[model samples]
Target: MSVFPSPPSSPPSDRRRYAIVGLGSRRELYQDGIEKVHHRWSALVAVCDSNPGRIELARRRSTQNGAPVPLGYLAADFARMLRECRPEVVIVTTSDASHHGYLVQAMEAGCDVITEKPMTTGAAPCRQILDTCRRTGRRCRVAFNYRYSPPRSQVKDLLMSGEIGDVLSVDFHWLLNTHHGADYFRRWHSHKRNSGGLLVHKSTHHFDLVNWWLGAVPVSVAATGKREFYTPAMARRMGLSGPHERCLTCPEKNRCGFHLDLAASPDLKSLYLDHEAHDGYWRDRCVFRADIDIEDTLNALVTYNTGATLSYSLNAFNAWEGYTVAFNGTKGRIEHSVVESNYVNGREAVQGGVAPGGVKIRVVPLRSAGFDVEPWSAEGDHGGGDRLMLEDIFLPEPAPDKYLRAADERAGACSVLVGIAANRSLESGARVQVADLVGDLPVPAYAPAGARGESVPMPERAR
Candidate 1:
């Protein structure tokens, strides 16, 4: 008889600790995971933000939710926080400009990193992040939570099983509806410098999904876009002479529903009003202004390493926040979508958009004579992917076999590499390749203190 080793007597408490940077809208990710999924193995040990009041607000919110109120810290700068907190992981939800600075520092400080989508703003920073990860041997995960949705995962499974045959080409169209789309124009993200344009900031998830589904990498991209609808010039032409910004304080604030009443939402209030004592940035602004550089609408053609082609379009001024995509394979086709709810336009806007229904999937087997449409069960937020991703991120079981959704540096790089290339293409009016955009950049040996760039708010109106 084979002798079996005795099981370890003690239970596992080897949970990894995390420190969150940038206490903004995304910080709820930490709180939700703590309450629902990762409660066992991980805890948010620290929270950092340039604004002390935001930090305090987060502590208060976490406490009310029964989580260990994390130790709050001011920016103290990212480098100092990494050294002081000594966490195993860092979650970066900072401003777009500050993403690279914090990511590089955390990796160099010997911590894994989980950053919000659109990993870094541009080619230079993207390369810097890739290089640092290459050097530091730390892992990096971009929160492209959509990948975990059961329907999308099922689509991937079908592709792998050759049920959808070899994917030939992909056609994707995403809409943001008025409530969700207009919100982009109202805040700091209105400017390109702050949010890297919606193409990079918002579509990173869409582009990354294409990369994942095709099992390929983007080779080249070319795009064109315009901000025709949401501009002050157009507003004036339409017979309205409102201020360049949203008329929140205008006597007609009630008439124009896009008004961003800063006091309406608690998060908005605590973050913008109370926190303004620390930093002077404003969260609410006009959607139509002269200074916006990002496009409200964009279209791009992408060629992948596997020679698959993808056509993409993004519009921010729609009536909802979701996407619908179809994959055409040599044998069959598969499509998926999630209709998002109305954005928190203001505190009093009680309207909510229930998910349209379910992910509608169809498959045409190579030998099939007809197409079969299947409706997947409806899921929670983010097409039901958010909760699953949190489980994999915050909790893991020890075993000879384990299910993992962890992404490393290369995966992280692949997701945003196309967006970076697209941004370059946007400016040069030329087709740009991912390799060329990041070529010859130095990856830092260790996380540095800050970035060497200027901060500009997203344009209030797309151009």
Candidate 2:
């Protein structure tokens, strides 16, 4: 069966021109959005990638979407692609460390840009993106799709409505189950240099949620991290002799529960396994390799500019995937949790989709009874945030969003800086101030609310 649904017969001529660099699995959302969903408003003009196989795959996908085959370019020819294609906007779905280069180059070429999260891996590249965006006056948007999820958006609305009054602190814990979490160890993400460990690569999502939910910038971070689960010792403990190079050649593939067969899925085979000679990028390396430097367990304390402190933790090898967050406010408390289904990336499955009846929200008032608040529901990936976010990104005139979920480079810096600070703290064992990393970063615009020092209604005496 074809992966993409049949697209519109003919797209309009006035559609915005878009080119996407980095033909990874993450690029599918934008590519399909341009060709299938918002074809009337957006046209994909070019695709670029380091691997020629993936570039061809993207062109094939365009044919599947019933759209014109976009021009394909190798990574080395990116500048030439920009000059030739003249894309109005460049969508960057590159690796965490390479995002800044593509973003800056695109902006310099007089094109706006949209990037997948973490924006960049380190502080230096982040500053470069910010400086270039400011100098060129080109819009640089960070695709923080988590903020657009219906249930998550509802949380912002509740906070804005001052239902729990001024938030004083936040407690957030995120869990990545073995199925999805283990996948990270099998890819380039296992290296700190490429991904800045899970703190910047994975925790960026959690930290950004706190920043957006509180409507404040993080000021400082103190953290500790360790690799306990996905380690060489764990391989022996699981009765494997030791870690091998890749899963395809691993001798204990039958014994190792974490073994991933790229050939089992057609998408993975075509996208990665079949193209091994082009870039030699393995889709299924052993999880218990000794060279893996990223941590599996992480904990951090973040202080916000609003004087709200956040206690956050991320465990990558949990039994289930999801998160639980609580807001401590001057008047009351709000708690939200969701259990997400497990799915490996690149496969034909929803990434971060909520399980059946997995969302729960509750409010507890001081000296009063607590009640369960119904969650806002949605369908599709990431609790339907991807769909809504695509509309906002590709649509010429999307509706005014009161939540202000559309994030820019400023918001991207605010979120990743927290994780970057945490990484430094892990190495130094001292609190790292965000200002020290990136001085005087402008705060992202947020919806106005009465919570920041406004007077709260006095509660009645307890019964």
Candidate 3:
């Protein structure tokens, strides 16, 4: 481990100051944006993490931008950072459980907030954060990066133009192969309390995209979830014996490629292995243990505020990553997908696919309609929305795609609200209403059949 830098102030900047919390996998994504985008729009003023080394690592990484590194503060406490650093923006990159805590504090301190997904584990905390933002009159943005991808954006544009007509319903399915999905089982995400299960944590992205595309709000949801695969008993049934320190040390190490070698990667080692002194939790563990509450597979039926319907499913133990989504509209239909041959490890993804990486789009016109599917444009990753979304977030001035591309807090909340409802539905074995979760956050415009492509004005309460 390298010696961490101490708090040092950079020259004054006109841009807003920001701080980061939770130095984990998601932190890296924000860091990517900070290095690439924050230079102009914002400045990383401070970083906070429970672990000393990660806090140190984040501080150093924030400063050393490969040029004249800007100096910033380092603190283990977010509250202290707020008082000392006085950042205008608070980036909550912490674990799922800690999201609401930092979010409330930041908003109450009169700072804008941008946090990673699931909003908060459940509606209880989500309500608190929402209330805080409302009372304090500060903005809260959820990082649903998937919505900004291009191919998906095209689908969004198609729906908005009524080219696909009124989006009556949607069918969405995603498969996370063993290489990709199993990674969740290895980390803190295995617990529902920590990651809000995949439905809230991961599906929040999928749900948000669908809401944006349909231009409607989720009204009600009924769901079911299960952990049919990856358990200690399953491992035992597979004839694996106990007490192995790690996968690489296991007798069946050769047979299990899903095994995580925690010590091999410097990033993993510095983040988890080296921090055992501060926290005893082990990062590498079998996914099937009894304490792992999150589901491996889940299914849901959703109804939108405009009465649009959606059937959704997600599976985590497939052979590859990516997802498939089909939108059924009154006039036409659009389907999109991106399937990987294998997982990308180190620098290279094991080769196996005919199509390009990321989601692809196919729009089909109804009989007597003008559009053609064969001549349609193709998109890459999240349907080519990633780069475009980055541009929307990072660019100093809005571009043509920016207005069509960005999703506001209401859009973000409405999307995750469905997952929050679904999680409740799964728990109660009954239908859960979206309003019960998010209390009627405003939604985007909706068009009835044959209506012109005009923005359906939102009511004051809806807004």
Candidate 4:
């Protein structure tokens, strides 16, 4: 890895100095947030990555953003970067399993941290993060942009307002169509050690949303997972001879539907294809490779501390993308669904972009007609949640949010532990308690919701 010299000294401004680790595509959100959107209050001081090419690319991006080029460092020199850059905050966008190390070290070094979701892959790292936060007395924020999506936040508001009464149970199903879902099997996420499967890496967004919406803690989970869709058998069924090492060198690329021509997209080529020699990390691995360990289909039954149960399923091979969720409450039911446009990561397309007229919401009161709700709308990626969340993160003092959308380590653990327990359950063929996975995981702070046993008007003798 090529290391750049120390950044030149300059007169300090009131803007918060920031350093970022891991220069993958996900880091661009925060990078642009600091340089372009919130430049008045935030500044990027340093960028680090395992691959030198990405580090150079990040610096070039800084120049392109009309910001001063930050110093660049290899992963081994992270501590050096922190010491030299003296950033007030460290933003971590590393691979899922590598998040905990950077988070812990950044906090111990007296810098606040903002990490991309899933926090860490497994229970042990989760415990380490919680313990490190407690011991160091530093802030660790998990960027859960899903919570900031207007329609989703509207759901939170309705629940807190007792629109659906105290929720008795929940049914949520998330679908990932071939385009976006298959991308997971193409990258490092294909291995459980790297991503903890979609159950954690992808569903962390969904799980955190549920935990936040209901104001509850997950207590136990029973789950089953399998990889039936993206496998050698499926590859054969599709008339391919068998899975090849990767799409770049595959002999059957012309016949395979899953082929990803990284060189075709300028963004993918610059971000991953051109940087291959540095790490030997293939950006277009075969989805049906036999070495893939993670599951493509998953189901889990979760029980919450609030006495509510959740029946959730995630399927990677679906006709459409997005999710349908319903909250079954004592007085009524709230049904919410969204259809997202399918797009692979690192491409020019919006990640998790909502389809036109994609959002739907309905509330059915007991013994009464159900009415449709005009879904709240926003104007950016991930249903505009990304822009709103960036404002929350980079702004010095964001407006006080009633939804309590800002999440710390507690909320992070709550979301990750569910997936962790589910993984354990998948192995043991039995229920796994969240507490058993990690103790002292306090319930996350949530906006007030309808409490159980609260007085409820009797439904007018259901006709």
Instruction: Give a tens-digit lDDT track for model 1, residues 103-160.
Output: 9988988999998877887777887898888899998877877677777777666766
What are the lDDT scores of the predictions, listed in order?
Answer: 0.70, 0.90, 0.69, 0.92
Task: Return the TM-score for each candidate structure.
Answer: 0.85, 0.96, 0.85, 0.98
Question: Per-residue lDDT of 1-463 in model 3, one digit per residue for the tens?
Answer: 2223444456357775777777765575566566655566666666777677666666666556632233233334567678876888788877787888888898998898887776777777877876787789998877776666445556666776776666778999988888768767766788887888899888988888777677666789999998877666766676666324455446676666557777887766776777767766577776555667788899999997667899999998886677888887766688877675554222122322324434456777665434434322324333344445556665677576533446545655777778888989998999998787767465443323334344533323422
Q: Using TM-score, rank the candidates from best to worst.
A: 4, 2, 3, 1
Give the local distance difference test score of model 3: 0.69
lDDT (Cα, tens digit) per residue for candidate 4, span 56-83: 9999998898888889999999999999
Residue 53's lDDT within candidate 2 is 84
Pairs that collide in candidate 4 are none
Model 1 quality (TM-score): 0.85
Worst 10 residues of 3 by lDDT: 345-354
The TM-score that candidate 3 achieves is 0.85
Off by over 4 Å in 1: 1-14, 35-37, 345-358, 366-369, 398-405, 439-463
Q: What is the lDDT, from 0 to 100, of the residue 378 in candidate 2?
A: 82
Which lDDT tens digits does candidate 2 get at residues 259-323?
99999899899989999898889989999999999999999999987889999999999999999
lDDT of 3 at 279: 64
Kindly indicate the candidate among 2 and 3 with the higher TM-score: 2
Highest TM-score, which number? 4
